[model samples]
Target: MARIQIDLPEHFGFSTAIPVYLSHINYSGHVDNALLLTLVTEARVRYFQSLGYTEMDVEGVGIILADAAVQYKSEAFHGEIMDISMTATDFNKYGCDLLWRMRDQVSGREVARGKSGIVFFDYGTHRIAPVPPAFRQLFE
Candidate 1:
């Protein structure tokens, strides 16, 4: 079977640290695959916050995740801090891709690589909107 491949940028515009708690572990004693998305979601929020925007208000328009993909590289155990880095790429009229990489902060071992396709949406209008200039500027 073919696997997902995420090509990360050479430099990340944002990074955040997340510690794996016991709750994040699976029956196999490592972080569950599903929880990796959760961690990336948290990193995405911090990425926006670093740019002074929220998920619901990124330069006046909210973001709706259009799609997501994750490629696991290594196992992460509970009680370890993961360093997640992200950047915006593959921009379009109304959306862009947020690519991410995660590694163990202590061991420098890669845990996962992923990307989320996000579209700007106007909640009141209930329609897709153009990418806000301010939001795009940060990625430039």
Candidate 2:
């Protein structure tokens, strides 16, 4: 696996969440991976919104996921408060990358880490395009 270490931004924000009844123990008695993705997705959308960006229409330049990677370091159980801290740390010609680190609110242990590759699209031409200069200007 190609691992990327993300340096989180100070302004990066988190979304509040509480485990649901449906998000109960799996047969193995742990939060399922599918639920984890759902939870992460919710927080990610909020992150983009905080940055004045989104999965679409990122400052008039549309972008979609080109690739994604996720790693599960630990498990979360029902009734847990999972604080998902997220940020947009990097971008390139082909796409931008969003990094996420989720942890237990009480224990301060990492529950998961993830990175997503976001590629720009020319909504008019219907073709992939380079990330906008403005988006690039937001990062290191």
| Highest-scoring model, TM-score | 1
**Which one is best on lDDT?**
1
RMSD of 2: 3.1
| Deviation in Å, model 1, residue 90 alpha carbon | 0.7
The C-alpha stretches of model 1 lying farther than 4 A from their native spots are none
Model 2 — TM-score against the truth? 0.78
Query: By TM-score, how accurate is candidate 1?
Result: 0.97
lDDT tens digits, residues 48-85, model 1?
A: 99988899998788999999988899999999999999
lDDT of 2 at 49: 78
lDDT of 2 by residue, 1-140 (tens): 87655455556545555453455467777778877878777787777777787767776778777777788889887777788877665666768777777788888877888887778897888899887777777665
Model 1 lDDT at residue 32: 94
lDDT for each candidate structure: 0.92, 0.74
Q: Model 2: how far is 139 from its true place, Å?
A: 1.6
Worst lDDT run of 10 residues, candidate 2, spans 12-21
Model 2 stretches with alpha carbons more than 4 Å out: 1-21
Q: TM-score for all predictions?
A: 0.97, 0.78
